[model samples]
Target: MPPVKIVTDSTADLPEELYQRFGISRVPLKVLIESQIYRDGIDITPDEFYTQLRQGKLASTSQPAPGEFASMFEELTKDGSSALCLTLSSQFSGTCQSARLAANMIKEKARVDVIDTRSATWGVGLMAIAACRALSQGKNHDEVKELVDSLILKMRISFLVDSLDYLERGGRIGKAQAFLGSLLSVKPLLSVKDGIVCPTQKVRGKNKGLERLVEIVEQEVGEAPIICAILAGADPEARDILHQKAKERLNCQEIWLGDVGPVIGSHVGPGACGIIYYSL
Candidate 1:
């Protein structure tokens, strides 16, 4: 069998260079700014998205249509290779549902497996990275699927948003709903729990929120050798510091730094940063 190809959505925030180097398939999501629609990571970059947001344009995102994934599956397996598509949480977006729908729509249905990772951003991307590693090790489709399945549960995502406006509008606030009743000036620390985004804590300002975020990550990984990634909306300066502190504090084996895609950035807005990691 040819190597099992890895697939993911734009919200995974996996670096583009890795996509080309590893032959990973990324299906872009839609980001709507005002009345304009842009493909995440393609038409609009993180810096561009944040610039527009700061300029007073509100944005929204949509999952890829089933036809998009169907086309991707056909292209990935055209040369006798199978595909393993790890997608964003179904609870957050319908991207996983679209992937599953596309899998059945394909002619070679058994040549692919669509998994709902129940994580977003690098949390979902980390599973794809693990699948790529397994594929490179000569593992077959089923073996790679098993590896990804285990990695999903071990993964964790924790973030601090500069504002709650986006989360409130998206209705993904979940347990974070408590933050809404408070003063609008408070920054929120959030986490993806049981497939839903929830609030973890609150602080007065940006620096304090970032400090709490690093502390949350250190507590979650706790000396484990998990591979880690830091994703920023438009706040690389703060994210870089968090990355260095995390590396020094958690003793992570490897770390990846990338921007949050436009779709996610739309909901989180600018000044959002987070960490996702797993021990696979």
Candidate 2:
């Protein structure tokens, strides 16, 4: 059997190079700024999107329509290859539902498996990358699916937003809603728990928040070999610091550094950074 094609939506936020290197297919989400609609990572970049946000532009995001997924699925599976599509959390976006609808629409043409990764940013990217590696190693479709399902359980995403304003504005705040209007200097450390964002702790300063994020990862998987990804939204300095700290602190076998895309950046806002990882 041919290797299964890996598909994911733009919210996965994998670095630009990995999509080409891994032969991954990505369907972009829409980011609306002012009167224009820009395809995430296609028409606009993270830097551009964050620059607009810093200028006080309001933005919103939308998932791709089902027809878009159907078109991609038809083209990719035209030559008899199957596809495995990994999407961000259904609790966060309807992208998974759109993909599933597309899958049913094209059921007569090919086999496509749409999985709600129950993750965001690099959490989804890591799973897609793992699936690609597994397929490269001669693992078949069923084997790859099994590996990805196991990864969903092991994956963890922890982040610190520079401010809660953007999350509150976008209505994706979840339990972090309580952090609003408390203090300007308080930073909330958040984690994606069971597909929804949940507040983990509150630190008084950015430096302390970064320290606690690394500590949380260290405590969870001490000395265990893991694959990690550090994400940033127009805040390379913070991302770099987190990367250095992870190198100094964790037993990471592989680490990927990427920018959060417009869709997630729209909700998390500028100056957001985080770590996503799972034990090997």
For each candidate in turn, give its C-alpha RMSD to the true structure in angstroms: 1.5, 0.8
Clash totals for all models, in order? 0, 0
Looking at model 1, residue 178 earns an lDDT score of: 81
The pairs that clash in candidate 2 are none
Candidate 1, residue 143: Cα displacement in angstroms equals 1.1
Report the C-alpha lDDT of model 1 over 122-144, residue by residue, as the tens digit: 88877887788778888899998
- Count of clashes in candidate 2: 0
- Highest TM-score model number: 2
| Over 4 Å off, model 1 | 107-110
Model 2 C-alpha lDDT per residue in residues 1-280, reported as the tens digit of each score = 8758999999988767999999999999999999999999889988899999999999999999999999999999998999999999999999999999999999988999999999999999999999999999999999999999999999999999989888888888988777778588888899998888898989998889889999999999999999999988998989999999999999999999999899999999898999999998
* Clashing pairs for predicted structure model 1, backbone only: none
Error of model 2, residue 264, in angstroms: 0.3
Candidate 2 Cα outliers beyond 4 Å, as residue runs = none
What do the candidate models score in CA lDDT, each in turn?
A: 0.84, 0.93
